[model samples]
Target: MEKAGSPLEQVRSSIAQACKRARREPGDITLVAVSKRHTAATIEPLLIEGHRHFGENRVQEAAEKWPALREAHPAVQLHLVGQLQSNKAEEAAALFDVIHSLDRPSLVKALAKAFDKTGRRVPCFVQVDVGDEPQKGGCPVSDLPALLTQARESDIPLAGLMCLPPAEIEPAPFFAFLDKLARDHGLEGRSMGMSGDYETAIMLGATHVRVGTALFGERPS
Candidate 1:
């Protein structure tokens, strides 16, 4: 944990340092303060500080917390960073500015119709199973190309690829693999990294980092 500054301030400073180390611009990286399990009361301070990018794990929770928050600060960018259920496609598409969990054919089909119905083309990241973790929700590594094609055919905006590195492992290689996959697919955005390894992700070309604990502390059990 940072010893000298508030969480948000410390994160910003770390992002700056990481960008410096990577020879990249800090402005090029999007910091998504993951606010799931946190009350709107806890999140409002970050909003008041001009932290406009936030992420939520569930559509219903976000719907309950953010409408009032966005009403107060209209420019907030909400990202759906959790595994989205195909049934919740409509609500998720309606609520989030970005959808980072595009992983399967059913979801692609569902979101296509949802986006058409809502007339909102939300930018999406194709979640790749970088760790090949069966417990995870991403598409299999071999299935990525087909999924990308499917999403493109549906006219979904392919922002990039995302992954959750298998926990309790060195994450840098996984981040690098996701970045390479993005490049090979002609995508620019790499939604890799979390609170623990975001700086490494930045150095490896992550355009979006989903930070939660380092900012808000661990989610309460």
Candidate 2:
């Protein structure tokens, strides 16, 4: 039955199975349907079926797409799952319910100011470069404590930790390490994993899984 339904149903079934395998309730994890580069038409069917949580990588794209969707269905929750720029902090804060890429000190300052000015404390996940890739958009593991301190001092509501492991390697260790970091920091949210490794992430205590291609099919280049 799981294999015969729409993508949404299939993804939900998979989540349930993953949760059962991990000995955790399906409700313990938030499945964020990553809708970046997908059109509003592509998203409406899922929305019609009551999938409220959606993630967009770019604030501009979300702005272009979501206003109409939100107008029709007011309960949809939006998340910023991409690297954010300091210059777009206020716009991102106003548009997104959660920011998953709170990595650098500059962004910390920008988001803090935006929240302070707007009186909206958007929940943030401090992204850590667990893969230690210079190209990835995350704070180095060594610099994580300091960044967390700065975020705390700046009054950004720290939701938890987020990470992306290096490509072409086993992600379980990285996910495990991310869980440990969240544990050590007393954070309950671990926004790790994607379509490929979300089951493993759930087993490792991930509170949120950002899934894209698995649910929406492949993205165009």
Best by lDDT: 1
Q: Which run of 10 residues does model 2 get worst, by summed lDDT?
A: 1-10
After TM-score superposition, the amount by which residue 97's alpha carbon in candidate 1 deviates from its true location, in angstroms, is 0.3
Off by over 4 Å in 2: 1-4
159-194 per-residue lDDT for model 2 (tens digits): 999988887899999999999999999999999999
Model 2, position 108: C-alpha lDDT score: 92
Against the correct fold, how does model 1 do in TM-score? Answer: 0.97
- Estimated TM-score for each candidate: 0.97, 0.97
Per-candidate count of clashing residue pairs (backbone under 3 Å): 0, 0
User: For model 1, how does the per-residue alpha-carbon lDDT over 158-217 read when each residue is reduced to its tens digit?
Assistant: 999999999999999999999999989999999988998999999999999999999898
lDDT of candidates 1 onward, in order:
0.94, 0.92
Clashing pairs in 2: none
